[model samples]
Target chain A: MTETQGLHIAVVGATGAVGQQMISTLEQRNLPIKKIIFLSSARSAGTKLTFKGEEIEVQEAKPESFEGIDIALFSAGGSVSKELAPEAVKRGAIVVDNTSAFRMDENVPLVVPEVNEADLKQHNGIIANPNCSTIQMVVALEPIRETYGLSKIVVSTYQAVSGAGAAAINELKEQARDLLDDKEIEPKILPVKGDEKHYQIAFNVIPQIDKFQDNGYTFEEMKMINETKKIMHMNDLPVAATCVRLPVVTGHSESVYIEVEKEGVSAHQIKDLMKTAPGVVLEDEPKQQIYPTPASSVGKNDVFVGRIRKDLDEDRGFHLWVVSDNLLKGAAWNSVQIAESLLKLGLVTVK
Target chain B: MTETQGLHIAVVGATGAVGQQMISTLEQRNLPIKKIIFLSSARSAGTKLTFKGEEIEVQEAKPESFEGIDIALFSAGGSVSKELAPEAVKRGAIVVDNTSAFRMDENVPLVVPEVNEADLKQHNGIIANPNCSTIQMVVALEPIRETYGLSKIVVSTYQAVSGAGAAAINELKEQARDLLDDKEIEPKILPVKGDEKHYQIAFNVIPQIDKFQDNGYTFEEMKMINETKKIMHMNDLPVAATCVRLPVVTGHSESVYIEVEKEGVSAHQIKDLMKTAPGVVLEDEPKQQIYPTPASSVGKNDVFVGRIRKDLDEDRGFHLWVVSDNLLKGAAWNSVQIAESLLKLGLVTVK
Candidate 1:
């Protein structure tokens, strides 16, 4: 390929919540792209989106949409990814999927670039992006695991409504206004829209996030438990999660407790290590009341961590609070980061 | 005592949030109260309140306020209780303190009526009501501990702003309105009122709940830890907590993970036990989307437990989601229940 002719990239689901963030994040990144195309479902195909000050009309995503694409990013729900991602791969484009369709597949590599970039070398034409909650947690824990060797994880999430997508964000705002005016609120989307029931997410917290699995754990909880082991290459590690939805519109916060394998590590030592950890910003200052919050972490790509404390009884136990923009680091930014890794590692070349 | 006469009850901090709930809970109960008096700080003195269809004027609380009181319920600040509680006891009043003043005292018994009503029999004078967050969690866990010996507890709380008092609730309302209008908000009284800083609790969850202790745990976290062991009479029970404050107005929700001493106990057995547990409501139907949320648990006195699931890997580990109105089961309702227990146990007599 000539220097002037770079990669031909396509973004599916270009009009959705995380898809919009993908467009903007790609604009801010320095990826060498000769041509960029926007693709979506038949319903959202005709929408116009501005990328890097140029208006691009979205076309309907079909098998032919990936004809000349060198790299394709897919976020158009699990079913869409399940159908279209293989087509894109067959058409010679490396697929970076933002859904859970292929995350646990034996052939596909589940990747958080900070934790497992090398896994890309073994991907069978498709690389899987983890769930939003799992992505941010792995970013914070990877450093600790590398330094101290991790054994177990127990997490409780304070997730945002925007994780459900654009409609859930609108629902939170509308319901909050109605609640403030003392009007009756009718919730249409939240805590799983396709599920049998919908609950108010304005001033309330919902414990269920996705559909419940046969084992009584929500799919969101299982994703965190399974994907953490896959990304960290620790299949025997014990992981537990309680995923919940909060009223926030953008970022997700997690209260994580972990037991390290090595002993005699102090909380201050872990704090000092996190000060320079990749893709993580340490915002801990208890006396000054500085900590990571969902509102404070919106619109950024870094995972913010704070409140690092050692358990009073267990010598190897530590607690951490992690927050990140669910759309950015959890989805779009991570997908783009994987593409950048492909380019840097010479795994995929410009067309 | 004559059959027509009952016990004399005095309510301190009658104008505050929990104090008002205490008065209403008393009115709804059959506690055999001959006379009820409202007492508050000098600032709230002379405020008119209603009890049993009659108006009562709030009086300034002093040592003499408990002269003829048979039972005194204190929800005022810790300092007020510290100064006046012993005086009340000297005048033959059994005090149920809702503050953190005497909860850890060796001589004072911390009581959660559903879990440890018999502990009231050994109270010297003051019976300490545990923290609001702690009270609701213990109520849901005590039945499990009774059937299967308990060993460990790891909890992450989603607490309400009302736990910080009325000013914090107004702060949440005002900040939420300001955020919705796209206006800058000045946070004055959330996370911690007397702490050096205040955070916006409108659409955000704050990791810190109270003043930071030397061990890096917030005072709220320490209360949940220390009080759980004391109330359950298992001083060495390994209890770990991360208490976070959410935007809800009334209910406090918790994601609790526990490991019982017994093995091979299925999640179904625990659900069946919770169905008949005292002061508990089991709302754990995943198919119908029936579960306890902070919004649904508002104004209810019982601790709502749902999302009970056995650990996929650990045989003895299980998780539960517990919620209740922070003001009711957490503070006011628990205090009145303790007063009733005192009468039933013959620990105190009608004057």
Candidate 2:
């Protein structure tokens, strides 16, 4: 290939929030792309998006849209991925699916690049991007898990409304205005839009993110639990998650309680380990009153961690506060990073 | 003394946030107070606030402000309470301090009436209100602690900007607007105003609420840790807190991981117990997509509990998602409740 003769790239669901970020991430990273195909539903087919100073008209994504595409990034709904991902792969594209569609499939490789990029080699023609919360988490913890044998993890998240979609972010803004104006506020798009009930997100938190499974854990929480095990290569890693939606627009913060196999480990030691870990930013300085905040983390790709302290009772337990821009490190950036990895490792050849 | 006689009252630092709430709370609850003496700093003297539709002028608070006052509610800064609580006490007014100035004092009684009302009998003229997070957590967990037997608690808080003060709330709003408008966002009045630097609370979760102590716990986290024990009357109870500020304006939500002293209790059993708990509303049905949201709990006084689940690995451990309006149950209503307890228990009488 010539110096700038790049791979042909296609982005499924290019009109959505995460899909837009995926397109931007690809542009910002400059991952050797020669041609770009933007796909959305038929309703959004004529939508125009500018990347690298060129206005690209989005096309209606059908199975035929994947023809000659070297790499396809699918971020439509899960159902869309369920139908379109295989078609893209069959048409000679290596698909990086961003939906929950291929995530739990035993054959599809789930990649964080920083955590489990090697899993990409095992991809059955399609790769899975883990949930936003799980992707940021395992990125921070996997390094520590390798150095210090792991036991258990319990995490409660402070997530931004943007994770739900642009509509939810708009809803939070609308409701906050109504709340402050002493006007009646109503809910239309939170907890789960498909679920029967909805709650306002303004000045509040909703505990349920995705719908609840039979196990009582919301689908969002179970995604964290199962996805963490898969990404960390530890199905028996004793993980628990409480996923919550806050009024933030981007970024996700997590209070993680961890039990390592090693005993008598001080919080400072773990923090030091995180300081050197890849894709992690350690901001734990108690004396100067330094720590991470989601607002400060917006648009940043690194996972910011602080508030590390040993558990008061459990000698083997430790606690950490993890924060990151959910759209960046959690989704779009992770996908871009995986594409970079695929290129760097010479795992994919342009047809 | 006749039962219908109005009771004399003093409102210390009446111009502040919680103090303003105290005034409105009394009006809302229709407490029959004979008089309200509005006291504040010398700078705030001559200000007027309407109470019960009457224009009450604030006067500079001095040692004599408590003279002939029956019940004094203080929400001034801690220094004011430190210099003036005893002065108010010596002048015969019963002081309900909303500052940490007197909390944890061996001679003073820290009371959350629902959790430990009888302790009011030992009060030496000062009843300390618990921290906002602690008050809400104890309100939700105290009943569970009583029925299930308490052992350990791990809480992660999604706090409101109002908890920092009215100025912080304004800062959060303005910063959000600036971010949306692509203007330069200034950071002030957040992550501890007294610290050397400030961070924006818009679209952010700052882990540090107060200045960090030597112990690495932000004063806010330490407050949740320490106040929870004193309120629940369990000094040895293992409690850890990760206090974070979201862009919220009023309510706070906590993800509480608790280990019960008893074993083999299902999540359903705990949900059943909390559904009937006093001062609590259980909104924990996952099937119908019903769960507590912070926006829904804003104007209410009761703590809302939901997202109850037993930890998959630890039969003794369970998770609870608790939410309450910090300005209400966490502060104003809680303070007002203490005053009502004093009046009902015949602990306060006009001179």
Candidate 3:
């Protein structure tokens, strides 16, 4: 391919929720894609999805599927990414992986374009996407961290069921219907699909997300804790997360309490920073009763932040309510943004 | 009335949600009640509610309604309590008010029986029940505070709509039904009914609980912060809260992080502390996928404590998940337990 030609792209797990979003985001974004292919597991193979009004048939993902593909986005599952991400990398395709398989790998660069676009230069053909909860949070906090160094972060997430996947979404809807009908609900896919003990996600909040780690923090919480440190390039930064799944379908909301290194930073100053911050929309107007809710944040690409206030006791501490479409800014849009960043920063050349 | 005979009891706002639970809790508890009267606003005065299998008509609460009453439990709105509580006190009745009106009054004791039962003895005539979210967290944390002094607390709540009122609960049910039917929902009561804007709470979470205070903290958040300090008698303790309303009907769950004054404390030690803590149930077996969820905590009087773990970075900091029925342990049962404490301590006289 010449330098003037559009890059060839492939979307793994194209039939899944974030995969479909990747395709749609790629179609909407100004990324130069010469050709696009959709791939999934054998189970989901033969599925048809639309891209820019064109129906694309999903084929079973294999090593050869990466041939002639310049960029590939993987979101099927961790096992699928672990099995095929290297194959795509071997075929000269840069893979933006949306699983936890290689996030902590020393060689991989976990990129949230707005936060660490420069880190894309360190990618070894495979770029890792941070956890959905971690991506939006870093996007909101990066500007603050740059303006005034960040000291500590404690976040409690009100996450959506969609993060668990399409089956989990279906379970949530079905359970809601059954619950409203006053019928018995047998939860099959929630908290974690592969883990034991599925809890009802309709009309209830489950404190467990992903599987519990030996340290009592769930894998999801650990991801948020670890990913933030890595993506922000601050390994010693104190970060803690309590990830809980809410009944919401799309957006993930976070109640973030942060301590900045600088003293006497007013909430108004932080609000001003968020207003001019990249990819962050300031929705904080308490008197007007205007704040971002998960329902209002659906299908949005930008992270919504509001409820910015200084901690009552600690002058260096501040509280913010950050929200974004979990499937978009958290997953698909983030991966696609990485691809766009690669092109924008000349990290990947077409020639 | 004599001490040998049962004491006269009156329940104000008997037609409301917490009032109804108060009646039921009174029936089940060992508190001696020789006479019981139900009272409400004039509009709900004639509503008939069953207590101890006997139908009691709610009368319009007036100064004369508390005549000869020894103990009066009030769950009416703040305005009603401010207007009638002193009247009840004048008639020789001690008031356990489940409203925000008297909670911050320095002269009135804000009692969470598990944490501050002894404070009941200091009540001049009116006692205040703590906010639903505050009551549950303090119950789970008081043991730790007693064992190792607490220095700081930060809590993010997954609160139920029932904390708003019976109308908010109905709104949640109706919105769920409407949303399940793919119908549009216009939320009228949620976050706060008196608040200007109403957001959908069916599949959504509202970060603002009550009205937003001038300091950018919601009234509910302020109540949790202030009331926790008052109940624990830690006037200078640093407490912060982000109170969010969930779609759940009854139970309120909190993600609480606290820093104890003493160091070298392990999560296991805290878990052990919770196992025997008064009004706290330890469900911290992560391997068994057992934790306190809003669904599992329904109808229970105790605060369900689990996911108790030390912060990964802060040696003095520990995290906990606490859940309890907002109507039972959070409001009605707490008020009744305070009355029982008053009786047990002989703070109230039947002579």
Better of 1 and 2 by TM-score: 1
DockQ of each: 0.76, 0.61, 0.86
lDDT (tens digit, per residue) of candidate 2 on B1-351: 122477778888888878788888888896677777889999989999998788989999999888888788888889999999899899987889888888889888888888888888898888898888899889888878998898989888888888878898889878766666678887978877888888777766778778887778788888888888887888899888888888888888899999999989999899888878889999988998777877778789999999899998888989998999888899889989998888778887534
**Ranking of candidates on DockQ, top first:** 3, 1, 2
TM-score of each: 0.98, 0.94, 0.98
Rank order (by TM-score, best first): 1, 3, 2
Residues A67-131 of candidate 1 have per-residue lDDT tens digits of 98999999999999999999999999999999999999989999999999999999888999999
**Compared with the true structure, what per-residue lDDT tens digits does model 1 show for residues B1-351?**
212679999999999999999999998888988888999989989999998888999999999989889999999989999999999999989999999999999899999999989889889999999999999999999999999989889999999999999999888888888888999999888888888888889999899998998778899999999999999999999999999999888899999999999999999999999999999999999877788998998878899999999987789999999999999999999999999999999987875
Candidate 1 clash pair list: none
True contacts kept of each: 0.64, 0.70, 0.84
Q: Model 3: which residue pairs collide?
A: none
lDDT of 2 by residue, A55-121 (tens): 9999999999999898898888899998889988899889988889989999999999988888888
Q: Tens-digit lDDT track for model 3 on B217-319?
A: 9899999999999999999999999989899998999999999999899998998998899998899899989998999989889889888999999999999
Model 2: residues with Cα > 4 Å off, grouped in runs: A1-6, A50-55, A176-186, B1-6, B30-32, B349-351
Poorest 10 consecutive residues of model 1 chain A by lDDT? A1-10
